[model samples]
Target: MLSNKNIIVTGAASGIGAQTAKILKQQGANVIGLDRHPCTENVDQFIQVDLTDPQSIDDAVAQLENIDGLCNVAGLPPTMDRLMVMKVNLLAVKYLTENLVAKMNDGASIVNVASMAGIGWPQSVDAIKDTLENATFDNIESVCDKHDVEGPRSYFFSKEALLVWTMRERWTWRDRGIRMNCVSPGPVDTPILKDFIETLGERAEEDMKVMDRAGTAEDIAPVIAFLLSDASAWVRGINIPTDGGMSSHVMEQMHQFAK
Candidate 1:
């Protein structure tokens, strides 16, 4: 159903984003892959972008002129800068969505590729709320200078806010017939897998119990393809965990598992 429909996939150079761009193209979307690094796939088009800069986002996406769907797969993951994580993961999401929303079809989709680290957003909402509001491309260095977060928590908070942003934007864009949602994957075996496992240290073993196995970019990318396609019409403002029921297992042990 996506034939000739222009779509944008950020972080298309590697991991989930790269896989997602490939999947979308196979499904017939005019895939525009955006990233700081060049992607290997011969996709519909490619535009290098440094998402930390608002102008870069504008210019990279401008290369598309207009698009039907946006897959926000760009991010630094955990074990990276707290502020940059938030900026790339959440702020850039807002930045691109705001700019591209006008260019999208009325019934287009906005899929924010979030993470399992974002699951506890309800509780941490207030703690990181200030940082999210203050995030800006022009002020990247300053935000990183202040309100420093460590380990997976930074990545967690960034995705958490993104999930929240998805829900919020769903309502914000509802009048325009646009839908916003998130896909949170668990223990994906992509390059970032080591980063997450490293950040968790010994706790990684226990965390793995939440899911039967680690996911792959292919496993998660198809879900984004669905959301970006007409397949997921009713899905909006929801974080659909593609972690092989791991999220449920963890949720089941919510009060039982300490840390």
Candidate 2:
């Protein structure tokens, strides 16, 4: 369904981004792979990007000035300092989306790779709202410097901001006929796994026990491909969880505990 489309897959050098890029290409989408690390497979062209800097992101988007879609699959685990994670995941995203909005075809789609960790957004919406409202070009470094949100909070907050921003973006771009959505995966076995496991410690492993089985990058890529194609034309600004039943299971446990 994506044949002839121009798509950018950030963090495409490894893990989920790499897999998604490969799948998108297999279905005939023209793909641009962007990452800090160089990738060895599944890309038509590679563009090295440092998503933290506005100038860098602007330059990168300008490079893909003719692209049709974007898969914002780039992110860092909790191990990085809060500012770094937020800068890479949220700030860079805001800058790129604003700049790239003009480049996209009216029907083009944006697929952001959030995580199950971010579904806590409802309770934290107020905080996220503040974060987004304050997202200025020069203030990202200061905010990260101030919050010191390193570790899990940085990763968590970044995804939450992404989820909310994309939803609002849906409304902002409704008149233009553009679409946006997010994919949330749980306990995926990727190169990032070691970082998550080490940073999250025992709790991360415990969280995995609920699913009993981990998902593969292959499992999540197709759903992303679906959201990016004409098949999902009517879909807009929804966060789709592809974590088997893990997210639902978490809800169940929360409900039980509330009792």
Candidate 3:
């Protein structure tokens, strides 16, 4: 469905990003994969990039033109420093998106890879809003530190911020017809899956039992592909859960517990 369209996939070196790049390529899109290391998949071209660095994003954007779609799939797990997590998962997204938005053709779509960790966004709205309003590469650490966003919490905060930002920017390019949305996956079996399992410990195992299995990149990529295609032209500002109904199951359990 994305035939002949030129799309950029970040974090394309491995995991979901790499799989998404391959899927988009099979759909006939010209895939430009970007990562700190070389991409060895279905990319037509690969650009080395450090997503945490604003200058690197600027340089990468300078080398591109007439982009049709963007998959913001590059991110750091909570295993990293909190400040670095904020930079890679949150700040860099804002920086790269703002830079690339102007260059994207009309009717283009932007898919941000969020996570089930963001399902608790309602509880953190105020803090997330504060971070969105003030977090920059230079000040991301201060913002994260101020909120005590460390370890696995950093990953949660990043996805929360990203999901909220996606909703907030829904109409940002309405005149140009660009749609911004996010996909939230549950415990996906990716390179960083172990990090999540390690961090969440018993909670992760409990979650796995509830869901019966962890997701695969293939399981999530199709939804992203649909979001980027013309099929989802009317969908906007919504976060689609590609998490095998884990979010729904959790919500139901929460309701029962509250009663």
Candidate 4:
């Protein structure tokens, strides 16, 4: 479905990013992989990038041209430093996308890999709006402090802000036929799954007990691939929960719909 397209995938060194690159290549894309480390996936090109650095992102973006799709998949886990999490998970994404959007083809798709942790975005509207308006690479530390986006909360906050940003930019590039969306995955069995369990402790255990199994990168990659393809041309600015019904379960609990 992605034949002849040149797609860029951040975090393509491993996990969902690598899997997404593989899938996109299988579907005939010329994949350009980006990550801090060398990509293990056999993409057409690989660019080592430090998502935390604006200069690094700018240099990487300069090398990109005629891109058809971009998957913002590189992210730091909550166990990392709070400020760094906010930088990679949110700030860098905004910077990268804003800079690269101009180089993308008219019908390009941009898919952000958000998390189920971000589902609480509706509850943080004021903070989201505030961050969207004022947060920049220069003042991210102060922004995090003002919003109490520290510790593990940084991960949730980053994802929440990302979802809001995705929706807000739904039509920002409609004139050029470019669209953006997100994929929110539940706990997936990646190398970082242990980090999530460790951070959330019992809450993570309870969530795991209620679910039949954790998802895999394989499970999440196809949905991302779909969003990157022409098949989803009309589906803009939506977050597809690739989370094995965990999102539905959470909504049921939130609304008291489960008997």
Candidate 5:
């Protein structure tokens, strides 16, 4: 579905990012992989990037042209430093996407990897908007402090902000036929799965009990590949939960839906 496309997949070193790159390549895309670590297998080209650093992102973006798709799959788990989590998961994504949009071909697609943690965005709209307006590379610390985005809250807040940002930008490039969307996976079985479990503690344990099994990268990557392909040209500004029914279960409990 992605034949001859020039696609970019960040966090392409491992987990969902790595698998997504593989699938994109299998579908005939010329995959450009970006990650902090070296990844030489699934992608046609590898660009080393530190998502926490704007200059590194800018340097990587400078090397690209005629991009057909971008998958913002690189992210940090909640166990990492709180500030670094916010930077990698939220700030860097905004910077990279804003910078690369101009270079993308018309009708290009951008897919962000969000999380089920963001499902409570409605409860945090005001905070999300405030952060979106005030947070920057220069003053992220103050903004994060103002919003209480410390500890595991950093991860949740980042995903919430990302979901809202994606929706707001749905039509930003509509004139050029470009679109933005996201995938929110539940506790997936990846290298960082333990990190999430470690961070959320009892909540993570309860969620695992409710889930049939943790989702694999295999379950999530195809949905990302679809969003990055022409097949989903009409799917814009939506978050598809590729979480093996965990999202539905959460909503069921949230609203007290009849069993």
Candidate 6:
């Protein structure tokens, strides 16, 4: 479905990013893989990048040609430093996407990989709005400091803010026919699965028990591919939960009282 297209897949070194890159390639796309680590599979080219560094992202984007799709699958787990978490998972994703906007084809699509962890965005809507309105690389630090985001909270908040950010920019590039969307996944079996287990403690175990199994990179890649394809031409500004029904289960509980 992606034949002849030039696409970029961030975090292509391992985990979901690697899997997504492979799928995109198998579907006939010329894939450019970007990551801090070296990726040896499923990519036509690799660009070393530190998503935490604006200069690195700038340099990476400067080398790009025509971009047809962008799969933002690279991210840090909660075990990383709080500041780095925000820089990579949120700020850099925004910066990198913005830099590539002009380089992208008019029919291009952007798919941001968010998490079920972001379901709590409602709790920080006010702060998220402020960041969306005014925060930039020059002032994101102050926004983080003002919100007192730290540790695991930083990871959660970054995704929460990212989901909101995705929705807000859904139409920002409409005049150019560029579209943006998000995919929020539940616990996934990946290189960093241990980090999630370590961070969430018993909460992670409880979720595991409820679901048949943790998600695999394979299970989530196709939805991302669909979102980035022309098959979804009419889809825009939507957040799809590619979570094996975990999201529906949560909603059932959240509204149990209504029943």
Q: Report lDDT per candidate.
A: 0.81, 0.85, 0.91, 0.94, 0.94, 0.91
Residue 245 accuracy (lDDT) in model 6: 82
Each prediction's number of clashing residue pairs: 0, 2, 0, 0, 0, 0
Better of 2 and 4 by lDDT: 4
Instruction: Give stretches of model 1 more than 4 Å off.
Output: 40-42, 138-148, 256-259
Model 3: which residue pairs collide?
A: none
**Candidate that beats the other on TM-score, 3 or 4, i.e. the better one:** 4
Which is better, 4 or 6, measured by TM-score?
Answer: 4
lDDT of 4: 0.94
**lDDT tens digits by residue: candidate 4, 37-152:** 98756599999999999999999998899999999999989999998999999999999999998999999999999999999999999999999999988898999889888799
By TM-score: ranked, best first: 4, 5, 3, 6, 2, 1
Q: Worst 10-residue stretch by lDDT in candidate 6? A: 250-259
Better of 2 and 3 by lDDT: 3
Residue pairs of candidate 2 with colliding backbone atoms: 82-149, 82-150
- The TM-score values for the models, in the order shown, are 0.91, 0.93, 0.97, 0.99, 0.98, 0.96
lDDT of 3 by residue, 1-259 (tens): 9999999999998999989998999999999999999886899988898888899989999988899999999998888888888888888888898999889999999999999888889999889999999988888878877888877799899999999999999999999999999999998999999988888899988999988788999999999999999999889999999899899988888778634
For lDDT, candidate 2 versus 5, the one ahead is 5
Q: In angstroms, give how far residue 81 of model 3 lies from its true place.
A: 0.9
The candidate with the higher TM-score, 2 or 5, is 5
lDDT of 6 by residue, 1-259 (tens): 9999999999998989999998999899999999999987989999999888899999999999899999999999999988888888898889999899989998999999999999889989998888777777677778888988878998999999999999888899989889999999999999999999999999989989989999999999999999989999778889999888888887888879434
lDDT value for candidate 6? 0.91
Weakest ten-residue segment in model 1 by summed lDDT: 143-152
In angstroms, give how far residue 41 of model 3 lies from its true place. Answer: 1.9
As a TM-score, model 2 comes out at 0.93
